[model samples]
Structures are given as structure tokens and as C-alpha cells.
Target: MGTSLQHHGAETSPPPVCRFAPSTTGPAHLGTLAAALLCWLDARSRGARLLLRLEDLDPDRCRPEHARSLLDDFTWLGLDWDEILAQRTLAAQHEAALDHLEARGALYPCDATREALRAIGRRAPDGGFAYDNRSRERPLPPGGWRACHEPIRVALPAGTFRPFDEGGLDLAQEPALAFGDPVVRRRDGAIAYQLAVVVDDAASGVTRIVRGRDIAPSTATQAALQTLLGLPAPVYRHHLLLLEARGGKLAKTHLAPRGAALGLSAPRLCGQLAACVGLLPAPEDCTPTDLLRTFDWQRVTTIDRVVRWQDGQLDATPADP
Candidate 1:
């Protein structure tokens, strides 16, 4: 066994490939920019390919202007990626992947209403909602929620349900013990996030996922989907979120000064962004070239930090590293 393991370790490994997948629902703020910078530095230091993916699947919320703004912001930051992909452009591909999962009996149709799900969640004693798989065998009436656990089987097509912990915190036996079967496709035909993200990542050949810590739960669902689809899971690195002065995280909707308000050129903004993530010195004046030379990934903090916007000035303070 040791010899076999040694042989496997001796095999050549592929080059590291990382991606920054950001939703184009709003302007790219400091939080998103910090994640992008870290991914860029990590990939560049390892001589790996850095790809940018626009997650614009939420058509109702995503806007073309936001996408353009994101591109502009990244360009201003002096970050370059090898390839860029939009989720809307790959709808057919994602649909095809869904069809494959459906064919394998891995997914089922769900007709649960938002209110019904919320009611179920409220009824749970532990405050954690569990789907009753049996609800899939028997159709629920209008305004009903389908159960993903058994003893109350709901109507579902013939398929093999994969075991998942939903929370992704434990790998225990009795697949249904932790999480009940989650819905992959809604009755209205809208794909769930778990299904969409997994399909997209696999199809795009994303090997590493870099993002904020808030979406860690979604990552677990993606991991389960990878196993069901027989695809390799990507490495995940959750960076600290940038917070606002009100003790809330900085969001695109926050009324911060724009490019003109900051009175900063492209080179200046690039330098400031580098300093925000502790990549360069915190001097008042530094050129973009200086930042490029000093860019280092080791200095990035693992704990959430604050990017306070006070009186038109942006102050970045590192939290627990």
C-alpha cells in the first residue's frame, strides 16, 4: 500500500488553475475587489492560469451595466485574467448538465412554495429545516411543501438520490441523517443554485474557487453535486469580507464615492486596492508599478476585515489574521 501511494505521489501534477466567480448583480465593491486581488496574486505567484467568470444567472437581478462596471473596475485595478465567461452565455450547457443528472435519477422536481418552506423551517425545533424525502413520492396540494425524507413519500420520477449533509460539516453514515433530499429543479423550471453552480464549475474546468466566507454553505452543496456528477471538486479558499462603518459588510449598494469622487487615476486606484489587502506599503503615494513588484499572497488575512468608508476616505484595517 505504501509503495502504491508513493507511486501516486511521484506522478506529475497538473498546473494550478484558479477562478474568481463574481455575481454581476451590482457594482464591484472593495469586498469583491479584495477577493479578486487575492486570487490574482495566488495564481500569478504559482504561474497558474487565472480565469474570471461572471455569475449572471439571476436575470431578474443582474444587469448589463453592472457587468460592464465589473469589467471596468478589474481593468482599473490592473488585474488580468486568461478567460472570461458569462453564465447566461452557457445556459444551454448548464441545461444539458441538468438533463444528464435527471437521466441518472439523481434529481427530482419540486413544487414547494417559498412560504411553505419557511413554515417548515419555523416548525423545526432546532431551527434547522430538514426535507422529508418521502414527500417526493406523494404530490402535495397547492401551497404545500414537498418533504425530502421518507414515511411521507412525495411523487417523484424514478431516480437515485445522492446522500448529502446539506451543511457539509460532517461526513456521516445514513445519507439522510444530516440532510434530506434537496430540490434540484423547481416546478417552474428554474434551476436551484446548488445544481447550477456545480454544473457551471465542472463545465468551466474551474480547479480552485476563491470567494468570501458568506457563501461557504453553497460550496458544500456544490461539493455534493460534484460527487453525484462524478466530477472532481475544486479547492476552496474563503477570504474575509470587507466591512462598513456601521458594523455591516461593505456592499455594492453602499453610497461610496466613485472613480470621479475619489479623484484617483487608474494607476492610483490599483495601488490603493493593493494596499487595502495589505499587499503593499501603506504610504500615501505609491505607483502601480510599485504595487506589482510588491504583490504577495502570504500577507492576506484569513479573518474578516473592515474597509470603513468614513467622510469619503477608505480605511482598511486587518482583523484576526
Candidate 2:
């Protein structure tokens, strides 16, 4: 890995490399479409290289069919990418990263179970149960940290860290207190999202990250990881999310309709997603290429949007014509 990038107050001059990383746990929904479109627009507008990365980290929920279907959805919606990658294919690199952290004495094996986490009863900013970093107090295995089969967590640096985001979002906080020391490796030996993403982005030389605002809360934690790993931090621009009216964000758990299941043509679905983020005046049938000329970060909405999936159609007030 390269040394930590110097922040000299000027953006990196290389043609930006951006990625649309989507988890393949389920079919692509409106929220997924919206995030994909925003990422495509941002990269295409700047004539940057865009990558489509399948985040199929969880073996339990992620399936091959879902990954194939997501690729089809992107193709149908006229979203093109310069390169593609699967997170699962890089397990060796993730393990190597863990090896690096362990060598630095920055990692510890954690045996805390989910039931024990619930017992602590602390809530994180993102509303999930916050880990109390109990593993920090435990001794490493007799052989070493890596000799254990338990989950591995990073010893996150202390003090508040305020990372810079191009979207003007406030990402200031102590990562350990905000989300606790994130698990870098699960007991099952799967590389956790936080560490995997930082390691992958650095290895791929990704310069910018454009995605939904819902991931904003995790930025500080990931930023801390980047610092510890001696990797370059990407410029971040979190776009608005397509949320369900009553249940919060549209997600696989909500059974939100996939782009194929939406019963709309490709251009029509692209238009609806574009309009939701202020890329278009209204939801008019169009391709991702059609909106590139007018795409501007300033035009994207910062507010979360409410959308409804009813009667075989998407009803988002902002996109309503």
C-alpha cells in the first residue's frame, strides 16, 4: 500500500476514479437505483473512470443470483462502468490487511457475542447497538492474535476526528465512541465491511465516493480506518436517499421492488431516480447519459426524500410530474 496521501489543500489532479458499490443481498430497489445513478452521473460528468463493485461480503444473505440480477439492472438502466469487481474475490488481500494491523499491535481478538452486546444496551448514532470495546481488555491468544478463531477488532485511535467531505456534511466524532471499535474480521473469518472497503478502495486507487447520505454516519469510522491503514482518503459526496414513507429508507428488508420488477422501461426508471436528486426538473424518461451534461454537485438535494411503492409504481413527491 502507498503511504498516507498528503492533504495539501488541493484536490488530486488524476482523473477521478469512482465506484458504485452495492451489496447483492437482494434485488436493486429505488434507493439502489438512485445511488447508482448519482454515482454514475458524478463520475461520467467529470470524465472519470467508474467501477461497479459487488459488495457480497455476507455469505448468509448474499447470493450469486442477486449479484447477476444487479448487473442486469445496471445494464437495463443504461448505467455503464469501466471496470467491475467482487468483494469476495479479494479475501486474501483482506487477510493480509489484518496481518498488517496485527503486526502493529492495533488489533485484538474479540469473543463478544451479539447477546452480550445487547446486554450492554448502548445505542450508536446509526441506531444499532454500539459495541463497548470489551475485547480491548482481553489478552491475546497464547500463540498470537491471529492464532485465535474469534472476531478481530481494531483498537481505534482516541480523540475526535473530523474528516473532510465535499458534500459539506459534518463528519466529526470519535469513531470508537460513535460506533465502537468496528470488527475488522468476523469469527467466521469473513472480512468486515469497514476494513474491506478501506483496503479495497486504496488498492484500487479510488479517488472519490458518491453514494446515499444514509452511509454518512459511518464516514468517521471508515476515515479512522484509512488513517490507521496508511491509505488515501477518497473525496466523499453523499446524495439524498429514496426513503419509504413510513418505514424509513427503501431496503431489501422492506421488499422494495427491484428495477426489473418496477414494470417501467429503463429510461423511465432513470428519470425518476434523477428527478429525486434534482438532476431533472421532473421525472421524464431519459438515459444516464442524458443527464450528465447538467449534473452538478450543487444541484443534488441534501435532504432525505420520502417515496412510496404502491400499485406497481413509485410515488416520490419530488419526482412527481
Candidate 3:
């Protein structure tokens, strides 16, 4: 048995393929820039190839101009990538993945409405919410399609994640207990983030993942999907999120200031972003190329920082938590 394991060791996935997947629901902001910088440096530091992926699968929110603006924003920052791709363009692959999962009985079409499901599940401990599944034989409600988790769970390694900074983490998770049944597809005939991401990461050869900790909870569901699809689990580096002192998390939904509004040169913006993640000695102006000289993963921290707009200026102050 041990001999067989050794034989397959050589089959471990190919060389590290890192990615910076920016959602196109809005323009890239300071926090987005910071996360992208870390992901870029980590890939470069390892001499690994980094790909730029526009996660614009959501039809309702993603717009054509936003994609153009994002591409322009990255070009201004001096961030380079081996290739650029978009999630929407890969619908065939996503559908294939879904077909595979469906055949394996790993996924089933859900017909419950959001309101119906909400009536059943309970909340989670993280101040976030989760759905508890009892998705048996329910009729497909009109304009109500929900993807449900059927008492399924995927296991994870246990530890902290500082994506792309320190080495990746090994954290454990029970999918069935925590995530319950989640919607992989929406009633609008659009694919969900969970399914699309796992499929895209595997297809793009992404052996490592670097993103903000705000979505850390997504690891388990993605992990479960990977397991179901028989795909390799990429190493993860979940970094700290840029937060607002009062509102919390500097999310795209907030329509935070973009690169244009920051009023700084591309190089200077890179330096500021690098400093936010402990990649530099201070948060002064610098270029992605300049900070590449000072990149060190050990210096990265996982604590969330407060980013607020006050006195007509943007600032980041460490939160007591």
C-alpha cells in the first residue's frame, strides 16, 4: 500500500499556477489592489506563472465597461501576468463540470425558493449565516431554483491562512455541518460562485489560491466540490481584509473608491498596497517592481485592518480585535 502511494507521488499536480481573480461587479479599489499585489508577488517570488482571471460569471452585476476598467487598472499598476481570461467565456467547461457532478450524484437540481429554504436553516457562529438542508423530494417552485447540499461534507486541514505570504495553511472543516446544502446554480440560469470558482481554478491549473480572508468560509464548499470532481486541492493563502471601522469589510458592494479616485500614480498605489499587507517597511509610494525587492511572506499578518474615509482622506488603522 505504501509502495503504491509512492508511485502516485510523482502525479501530484503540475508546477504552481497562481491566479489573481478579480470580480467585475465593481471597479478595483485599494483593498483589491493590495490583495492582487500580494498574489502577484507570491507567484513571481516562486518563479511560478500567474494568470489573471476576471470572475465575471454573475450576469446581473458584471458589466462590459467594468472589465475594461479593470484591465486598464492592472496595466497602470505595472502588474504583469502570463495570460488573461474571463469566467463567462468558459461556460462550456463549467457546464461540463456540472454534468460530471450530476452524473456522479454529487449534485442535484434544487427547486426550492430562497424564502422556503430560509424558513428552515439556522445561522452560523461567525456572524455569518448558513442553510441547513433537508432537501428531499420538493417540487420545483415557480421562479424558485436553489442548489442544496445533501448532508454532504468535505474535510480540510487545520491551521491559519495568510495566502501567498507564509506557506499555505492546512485547516480542517466539516462541510455538511457548516455549509449544509448551498446553491450551486441560480434560478436565473446563471452559475454560482462556488461551483464556477472550483471549476475555473482546476481548469486554469491554479495550484495555489491567494485571496482575502472574508471569503475564507468558502474554502469548505469549494473543497467539497473539488473532492466531488476528483480535482487536486490547491494550497491557499487567505489574507486579511481591508475593513471600515463602522461598516466593516471594504467590499466591492460598497462601491469603494477606485484607482482613479485614489489620486495616486500606479507605482505609488502599488507601494501603498504592498505596505498594507506588511510586504514593505512602510506604506509609502512604490511600484510593484520596487516592492518585489522587499517581498517576504513571513512578514504577512492575518488580522483585519480598518480602512475608513474621514477628514477627506483614506486611512488604515489597526482594529483592537
Candidate 4:
């Protein structure tokens, strides 16, 4: 029998390729800026290439003005990227991936409407209504998922798939229960975030994923999709989220005020965001470049940040332990 041994003189791994993909559904808010800053710092600190991907696949919400505004916001924050991609422009690739999943029997048309699912669904761990996977009981149409106009969902394998995170975030979950077979394509012909993100990251060779911890729950599902497609799984680090003091996340749906509208300069905004994640002692003026050399994941706080928007300014503190 051959013995397994570590190779001492193996070639070094390539530099990580990181990306910040923000949906173009709304203007960039404090949460958006903070997420982008963390991703930028993680990539730049390692001298890795970072990509700016505008997730404009959702036609119902994504707007051209929002995309342009986001590009400008990142530039103002001094976060540079090696390449820029718009997800909507990659429809062909997304379609090809769907085709692959369909041929593998990993996809099925989900005719269940949101109202229907919510009627008989239980609350999932992620707080959304868990899909019953009732569609799996029905046979595919004559031509399969493509022939049906219903939303397409990926049928994740039945097992507890866990993906490791460098920051020690637990991402072990049965995706079929946690996410309940996420949609890959909506009835409106829009590619869903889960499928598009998996395809885009693999195609772009994304090796490091750094985003808010709010997205940690989705990691297992994405990992499952990666395995189904025979793609490599990247190292992940889901950081702290900036939430409002009232016990809700700072989100676009809440109409969270934009950072620019607060009248804070780029340096001040960067410092504030850094402080929220334990990168700074307090909200002071600094640039992303200023923290590049000293950036270390060890300093980042795993706790969520409770922030308040008062008097047209932002203040942040750690959530109660």
C-alpha cells in the first residue's frame, strides 16, 4: 500500500481572487459599504486580485442608476478592483449552468407560489419559510425544467454538508432543510442569486469569500452546488454584520440611509466601518489603503455591531454579549 505524505517542496498556491458582489437594487448603504470594505481589505492585504461584481440579475429591483451609484461609491471609498462584471450580462453562462444541472437531474420546476409555500411551510433556521420540496413529487415536463415557465429550483442532496471557514464560523447544515432547495431561476426569467453567485465565483476563480455573517447560512447550499457542478470550493470568512439598534439588520429593504447622504467623507466613513468590525479603536478618519499593511483577521470581531443613525450621523457599538 502507498503511504500518504505531505510534499515539502510543492509549488505555492496562487494569490487569492476575491470579489464583492452587491445587488444593484438600491443605493449603497452603511451595511453595503462595510461589507465592501472588509472584502477589499481581505483581498488587498494579501495582495490578491479583487473583483467588483454588480449583481444586477434581478430585473424587478435592480436599476441602472443604482449600479452606476455603487461603482462611484466604491471608487470614492478608494476600493480598487482588478475587474468589473455585471451579472446580468452573463446570462449565457448562467443558462449553461442550468442546462448542466438539468441534465444531471439536479433541477426541477417549482410551480409552488410563495403564497402557497408560506401556507404549509415551517419557519426555517434562516427565518424564511421552508419549502416542502413538493415539486420533486411531480415528474418533469416533456422537455424538463426549460419547457416549464415555473421557477426552477436545485434539488440539493440529502445530507449535512459543511464548508470550513478560516475564521471558525460554523457552516454545517443540511441545505435541503436550511434553505429548502433554493431557486435557480425565477418565473420572470431572472437568474437567482444562489445559482448565479456559484457560477460566477467558479468562472472567475474566486478563492476567498469575505462577506457579512448574515450570509453564513447560505454557505452550505452554495458549497453543495459547487460540488454538483464539479467546481472548487473557496475558503470563506463571514464577518460581522452592522445592524440597527432596534434589533434589525441594516438593509436596503428597510430604506437604510446611504453613507453619502450622511455627509461623511470617504476617510471618515471608512474609519466608522472599520471600527464596527474592530479594525479601529473608534470612528476616526482613515482610508482603506491606510489599513492594508496592518489588516489581520484576528482583530475582526465575530459579534454583530449595533448601530444608530442619529442627527444624520452614524454611531456603532458591539451587540450585547
Candidate 5:
């Protein structure tokens, strides 16, 4: 693992390596463009190498066409990365990390189904489910399987694996708070995102992570995994989400169709992205390069608002989108 340090003014430390990990489950959209652009700008400004990592570990959902489309989409947006990594090819590396955790007693087998979890949640008065630590220590139920486990017998650093508090940040506050011993390896014999990502980031020497605020909660989980695995934690920056007309974050699966109705020309899409982050010199006249030149981390607002674009109108949504 590599160290990431801050230097005094006029003194320079080695530039941190950054990475963009995108899931290839569907088509790339405006949010993807914005994230890639921000990451590229940040890496360029610091003279750092930017790597593109495809998060396609879930075999059922990921497709080659989706991966190819993601590459094409980023290229069209004028963003380039130093290296491309595919998660599927790195399964052994991630499996090793999971094995390491299991050996250290930091992970346990989880055999709970989605339906069971939903029932647990419904039974709780607060509409949230809590795993009973005592019950979790027991054997699996008949027909029910292991769901999640804890690091009971492992020696860990003090203050590690603590509860995460979102405090209205719209991100997962902490891994333990929402999930206890969340499945590192699923029943289907697939590695979970939490485990795979940590191993990949560590192996790839990633030091900075920039993505949408929607995934900020997952950071806490990743942070805990890093500490347990003795890997360096990356600096995190969660950007605002791009929204749709119904006040929902635009997911790859739910994004507007690409063509006449959405008016999604590469140039036009890039211009809208620039304006979303308040990088417009004059919305109609700004080019991608112009926006890139002016882009700086300091200029990024902490506002977690939803960016919305419709029939020639752009605005922010008060609700989560």
C-alpha cells in the first residue's frame, strides 16, 4: 500500500494516483460524463495518473456491450485514462483479500436472502432491521442460511470498524450502522462489491476516489475494509448527482434514451455537464476544453443538490435525485 500525504505550500509531495470505477450494467449517462470529467480534471491538475476500472464483478448484470459503450462514451466526452482495469480478470486478487479477512476472522459466512431481510425490517418498529449479535453467533436456521458476520476474534486497530453516521449527508454514514458483517462472499460464490473494490483499489495503487454523492455511504464500508486489510485509504470526494424529470437520480438503466428526444449530442451533453457544476462562461458558448481549463477542486461546491435538465431548462431538485 502507498501513502497519501499533504505538503506545505510551495513544497511538493508525490502526486496521488486516482481512479474512476464505473459499473458496466447499462449505458453511460450525464452523471457518468460529469464524474469522469471531474476525475480527469483533478488528476491532471495534480499531475497524477488516472486509471479507469470497470466494476463488472456481477456477472449476470454486466455485458461486454455496456463496457464498450462506457469506453466510447468517455472518449466522446474527451476524457482519457492512463490504464483500464477489468474486475472480472482480477478475481483471484480479490478472492485472496477475502480469504485474508476470513483467516483473520474479520469476515463470516452470510446466508440471508433479500426477502428475509425485508421481513426483518418490517418487524422493527423503526422500519429498520438490526442483527442480533447473539443470534448471529449461533448456527444457521433450518432452510435459512448465513447472512452476515463480525470480526470477533481478530486483533484490529483501535477505533476501527466503528458505526458510521450520515448526519443528513445523503451518504451511508457507516458500514456497521446499516449492515453487520455484510456478505463479503455471496451464497452464489461471487465476491461482494465491498470486498472486490477494496482489493482492486489496493492492488491498483489508487489513492483518490471521486464519484457521485449517491455512493458516498459505501465509502465508510470501504474505509473499514481498508483498515482491516491494512491497505491505505484513499481520499474521497463525492460529487452531486444528475437528476431526471421525475426528481430521480439518472441511473444508467433509467437515463433518457439517446437520440432526438433527449437531444444528446456529445457536444451538447458536455456543455450541459459544465453548466451543472457552475462552470459556464456562457452556457451556449462553453466547450468541454474550456470547462476543463477552469476546473479545480476548490471550485466544486459542497452542495448536494440534484442537477436537472429538461426541455431547455436546468435546475436543482430539493429532494434526493
Candidate 6:
């Protein structure tokens, strides 16, 4: 593994290499599309490389056709990526990372099943397990899974601190409090997202990352992972989330229609997205080039956008056209 990158300052590069990794669990949703566009703009403006990585870690949820459609949609928007990589392709490296962490005494065997853990009330209010450390003292059970969350080792600000995003969203207290001991690998023997991302980013030399702010809380925990693994932490810019009318934010799992289903040309689609994001002077039709002419980070909205994403278009305003 490469040495941890000094990503705290601007002197680290001409511009950090950014990436927009979309999961292929289903078709690309509006929120993911917006992220892809924004990340592309960030890299393009900086003359830096923008990578497209498919986060198809789940065999059951992610489909090959979903990935194909993801590429097709991005291409339709005229969004270009330098290199395309798949997370599943690097399974060996991810597993190696898990082993390395274990060798370094970072992981502890976890054999408790869902029923067993829940019996002890380990499930938290958020639907995720609070993961009481009762199993920590137990011997390594046969065919047990492994994890590591000890020493916390993460150090952030005392009170309020900007975790990510343009709005300066503050973590309640210490950022590390947001995450517990994370599962490095699943019982089914699959590498987890945290370890895989840190390891892959280090290998790819990805210095910058732009994604939705929904996962912003993980930054601190992942930072600790990078520190422990002796890998570089990339600069992160988590943008405001695009939410649905109710329920939850638009995601690939929402079963939203593909971008081609909108029936708009690439330039028109780009123009509409730019207008919705406060990038255009007006909501009139325009192209990616036109949006680029006036693109400025200062102009981006700092709050969440409730875009009524539909089959035809995105309604950013409550008043219907």
C-alpha cells in the first residue's frame, strides 16, 4: 500500500483526482445523476482526471445490465470519465486488506448471527445494530466473521466541525461518535465498503472525492481506517442531497426510470439539470458548454433540493409548469 496522502492542503497537486462511483444495484436515480454531473464539472474545471467506478459489491442487488445502463445514461449526458473500474474486480485486494488489518490486530472474530445479536437487543433505533461488545471477549467461533472498532483512534474537533458538504453540516459532537466498530467483512465472506474504498482509492491514487452528503458521517471512521491501513485520505466534497417528495432520497433502488426514458437530448437534459441546480441564468434550455461558461462553486445552493423527479423532467419548484 502507498503512504497516507497529505490531503490537507492545496499544494498536494495541480488538482486532486476526483471520482464519481455509482452503485449498479438498479438504474441511476436523479440524485446519483446530479452527483455525477457535479463531479464531472469539478474535475473538468480543474484539468484533473475523473474516474467512473462501478460500486457493484452486492451480487444479489447489482446487475450487469444496470451497470450497462449506468454507462449509457452518463454517455447520453455527455459526461466523460477517464478510467472505468469495478469494485468487484478487485475482490482479491479487498480481501487482502481485511487480512492485513487482522494481522495487525485490528479485527476481532464475530460469530454472532442476526438472531443471536438481536436476542441481546444489539439492534439500534436506526435499524442498524448498535453492536454491543459482548462478543469481543469470546473465542473465535468456527466460520466466524471478523470486525474492528476498538480504540476508536479517531480524533476530530471537540464541538462543531464541518464534516463535509458546502453547508458546513456539523456532527453532533466528536465525529467518531457517529460510527461503531465496522464490519470489515461479512459472514458470507464479502469485503465491506469502507475497507474497499480506502484501499482502492490509495491504489488508484485518487486524491479527491465528490459524492452525496448522505454518507458524509462515514468520513471520520473511514479517515481512521486510512490512518490504520497507512493509506492516504482523499479530499472530500459532499454535496447537498436531492430528495424525493416523501419517504427518502431518490436512489438507484427507487426503481426510477432511466435517463433515456426522459426523451430529452443530451444537451437538453444537461441544461435542465443545470437550471435546477441554480447553474443557469434561467430555466430555459441550454447545453453543458453554456453551463460551463458560468460554472462557479460559489453559485451552488447550500441546502437540500427537493426535486420532484419524474419520467419527463425534474420540478425544482412547488408551482407546476
| Model 4, span 157-177: residue lDDT tens | 889988989888789999887
lDDT (10s digit) by residue, model 6, range 173-210? 23333434566666556566777788888877898887
Error in Å for residue 241 of model 3? 0.8
Which digits, one per residue and each the tens of the lDDT, describe model 3 over residues 74-106?
778888899999888888878787667655545
Give every collision pair in model 4.
Answer: none
Please, what is the whole-model Cα lDDT of each candidate in the order they appear? 0.62, 0.82, 0.69, 0.84, 0.66, 0.67
Model 3 Cα shift for residue 60 (angstroms)? 0.7
Top lDDT model: 4
- Model 5 vs. true fold: TM: 0.78
Candidate closest to the true structure, highest TM-score: 4
User: Regarding lDDT, does 1 or 5 come out ahead?
Assistant: 5
Q: How does each model score on TM-score?
A: 0.74, 0.90, 0.82, 0.92, 0.78, 0.80
Q: Is candidate 1 or candidate 4 better by lDDT?
A: 4
Full ranking by TM-score: 4, 2, 3, 6, 5, 1
Runs with alpha carbons beyond 4 Å of true place in candidate 2: 1-12, 143-145, 253-261, 310-313, 318-321
Query: Could you give candidate 2's per-residue lDDT for residues 1-321 as a string of tens digits?
Result: 889976778686779999989999998877887888888888998889988889999978899999998998788888889999998888777878887788778888888888888889998888888998877866667776568788889999888878778878898989888789999888876788999988888878899998777788898899998888888989898777777766478887554444455677888777877777777777898998889878887888777777876675556664221
Residue 64 accuracy (lDDT) in model 5: 89
Off by over 4 Å in 6: 1-14, 111-129, 139-167, 171-177, 253-261, 309-313, 317-321
Worst 10 residues of 5 by lDDT: 150-159
Per-residue lDDT tens digits for candidate 5, residues 1-321, read: 999897767965677899998898998876777778887887887789889999887878989899988998788777788899888888878767755765565544344555766666633222345432223344333332233342222122233343232223433344554554455666556677877888898898887777777666566667777888889877776776666666666888655335565756666767766666656643454445667677776566555446665675555544442
**Residue 237 alpha-carbon offset, candidate 3, angstroms:** 0.8
lDDT comparing candidate 2 with the true structure: 0.82
Q: How would the candidate models be sorted by lDDT, starting from the highest?
A: 4, 2, 3, 6, 5, 1
Error of 6 at 194 (Å): 1.5
